[model samples]
Target: MPIFLEAKLLVWLSPLHRESWLWACPELEEKPYAIVPSPIDPSQFYDMKLPREGVICVTSLFEFKGRKNVLQWARDHPGQEITCAGGNPLPNEPLPPNCRDVGQISPWQVNETYNKHKAFLHLPATPQPFDRTVSEAYLAGCDIIGNKLIGALSYDWFKSREEVAEHCGNSSKLFWEKIEEVLND
Candidate 1:
């Protein structure tokens, strides 16, 4: 806190963090700060034109990521194919027969994974600073199924997949500009 208090600038990863962090230390308001989300490279995730099918969740299956909720939802929809990817697996929470736990995949495989699925389910139990997976999934042309707790959804520009994709396409430029401003200041 003291280090931050003495800093010339602070860069928050998302708008949600900017709000929540400021509330934690209102004194920080006196300093310059910028909300620069971690940029997602849209070039990696292709926009699928072909009709996509099934549901895929790319988040780690940690307890805090609402794994139990996802499991229950999968159980309720027994016929639906839910592909659960990523690691940090919880103990004893067996996946429903309908849900397939593919565990983690390489970065090169992420785009392919998103392309294979029609919908992306992101239901974190707590507020994430910013989940780039949401942005990646959005760019890959997957319909996002997430709660309001998704920090990226707070942005006005995140209205639709196309809108989010546009923002992400320019995210690198935006991020660097913010950094340059901070450096110059």
Candidate 2:
């Protein structure tokens, strides 16, 4: 299920993300971390200048075919730390030393993490059309960022990318000031 980001919260993304920090797993303390999308792209955006030490990587993690690819992906990259929650874990696999399983975090945790860090990262390049992570991250006060693969939307694009980002950035102060702007017109 996809979460619909309210128009009031979309404006925050407008400001260039300068925090240089990302909501990451506790295990990140011990490793060089990076955020990567679920549908891995070896070519697109390859060779990123890894962020400075302690700078969190804002990237996507995903639930793949009853097996969480994000977990294995993180394992493959020993030094990279990752954040994964909100769904069932990959069954029968041994927990990787670097993977920090936060379990299903409550919405409050998302909000708290957003406030304390740069943003809650999880822009998995999922082909399943719309990804609810956007709405969840925004509602939690994160600046909803997009992964490159952006396949589909739950509603018309006009409704999602537009209003959701608008609400996230709070394009109109009135929208943030007034509750009316939270819903689709």
Clashes of each: 0, 17
Expressed as tens digits, the lDDT of each residue in 1-185 for candidate 2 is: 01112122222121111011122223223332222112211122111222222111222333432134444455566775444455434435565676555566665454444444334444353333334454544433444334433322232332443355443333335433433434443
Q: After superposition, how far is residue 103 of candidate 1 from its true place, in Å?
A: 1.5
Per-residue lDDT of 113 in model 2 = 41
How do the residues 1-185 of candidate 1 rate in per-residue lDDT, one tens digit apiece? 99999876787767887777778889888888777666776678777576678999976477777786677778878988999888746646677888888888999888888988998888888777788898888888888888877778778888776677677677678878877887897
Best by TM-score: 1
| Residue 6 in model 2: lDDT | 19
Residue 158 CA error for candidate 1 (Å)? Answer: 0.8
Clash count in backbone of candidate 2: 17
lDDT, candidate 1, residue 122?
83
Model 2 residue 64 lDDT score? 32
- Candidate 2 TM-score over all chains jointly: 0.39
